[model samples]
Target: MTGTLVLAGTPIGDPSDAPPRLAAELTAADIVAAEDTRRLRRLTQALGVAPGGRVVSYFEGNEAARTPELAEALAGGARVVLVTDAGMPSVSDPGYRLVAAAVQHGVRVTAVPGPSAVLTALAVSGLPVDRFCFEGFLPRKPGERRGRLREAAEERRTLVYFEAPHRLEATLTAMAEVFGAEREAAVCRELTKTYEQVRRGPLAELAEWAAEGVRGEITVVVRGAEPPAAGEADAAELARRVAEREAAGQARKEAIAEVARGAGVPKREAFDAVVAAKNAGPRG
Candidate 1:
């Protein structure tokens, strides 16, 4: 029988945040795969646990070359523990390759849950937290990133993102353009660590703050758009929205009401949308 694979989460900042299970796993495992061996040493020292196992580097550069070797160890019934620099493994970090290979080989996989910057930032973001999606990292190239941002402009659930300090300003600027300047957002830096800061404001303001320079890991949370104001939409714009929905297969009346809800306009005024559509015909 193949041995089980354990994916342990490391502390994002405060060493005290390290869970007891992490230390137990480290000492119990037959081998430990870490993103940074030096950091792993520091972590074990912090946890005050004697690692009774072999330590190996399993970062991005060597992930491909090391996957097969690690799988072989597991096949030999060796308990393997995987750790990243911070947070849970495979969450925008190393460990995914091993997990995938383990699954392919029918190896048991488990995790020691620990602190997460994504959850921490979202909790304190003051935005809607009922539903959310994590966008691990955006494209470094401006055009590709902007295109992706545009697609999520109207997403109702709050959005979470990770970005390098160098690109935070540019990414925030693109978010302002796509989601609108007035959209609410929070920039969380060095979460749960010294110099931790959470800047809450409109996306445009956040963009300006990022321009001044930022350091440490960052998690950005942005509120969904409030939708366009239907009272401010005018007749033509209302017709356009209704027509667009109808083009997508909604009945004319239903489409108008839905558009009204989205635009924050009264349903009565939205009724005019159907009439406008008739007058304009199917041209536009």
Candidate 2:
């Protein structure tokens, strides 16, 4: 009998958010794989449950090397419980390789669901939640980050992202520049913690607010663009929007394409308008 590979979710902030099954699994597993051994020790201590098996660190640095060993343990009928410092494993964390290895080895895989920052932030964002996408984190590089925002400029579904506190203001400023200053958004910080705060406003407004400084795990939710209404499209407006995007550091080609799509107009018309505007020279 092949042992099961359990991917358990730890608390994001509050300890009570941990599901009852998590404690049971912690006590019963043959081996516990933790992202942070010290944090895992604290969690176990909080839950008052001691594992009957060995506990080993399985963080990003060692994930690749430790996966095979964990898979072997599962193959040998040792129940392995995998847990990150918070949230589910493999979600911007370590665990994908181990899970994939277990699946490939014919080992059964399962999850013990718990509190999730993504879902929690979305639920409280006050934005359309029916359709959405999770963009875990933006690139650290400014050019790459701006390019990514420009790519999602016309997305109609709500967008979610995790950001470091220090980068929040810059990110929001970039977002305002790309997505429009008036775009609605929310900045959720320290979710479920004592100092939890959700600042909701236009991208420009939030950008200015964040400039003052913020500290915590941050999740940003931005309302998606509303599709252009029938017969309301203006080629000039599309071209101007494209120009704004270009000025904000987005590639000219991408700006044109995104603007055209967003305005529900032909790309050729948008391109022509931009060309005409450029040829007309600077305004007096």
Off by over 4 Å in 2: 263-266, 279-284
Error of 1 at 167 (Å): 0.7
Give the Cα-based TM-score of candidate 1 against the true structure: 0.82
Question: Model 1 off-target regions past 4 Å?
Answer: 227-284
Candidate 1 at residue 154, lDDT? 49
Which residue pairs clash in candidate 2?
none
Model 2: per-residue lDDT, tens digit, 1-284?
Answer: 89999999999998888899999999999899999999999998888889768999999999999899999999999999999999999998899999899989999999999999999999999999999999989999988999899889889999999999999999999999889999999999999999999999999999999999999899999999888777656766676788888888777887888888877778898899889888887888
What TM-score against the true fold does each predicted structure earn? 0.82, 0.93
Per-residue lDDT tens digits of candidate 1, residues 1-284? 89989999989999999998999999998999999999999999888897789999999999999999999999889999999999999999988889999999999999999999999999999999998989889999987897677556546778999999999999999888666689899999999998999999999999998888999999999997555654567877778767755553446776666667766679777787668667778675
Residue 182 Cα positional deviation in candidate 1, in Å, after optimal superposition: 0.5
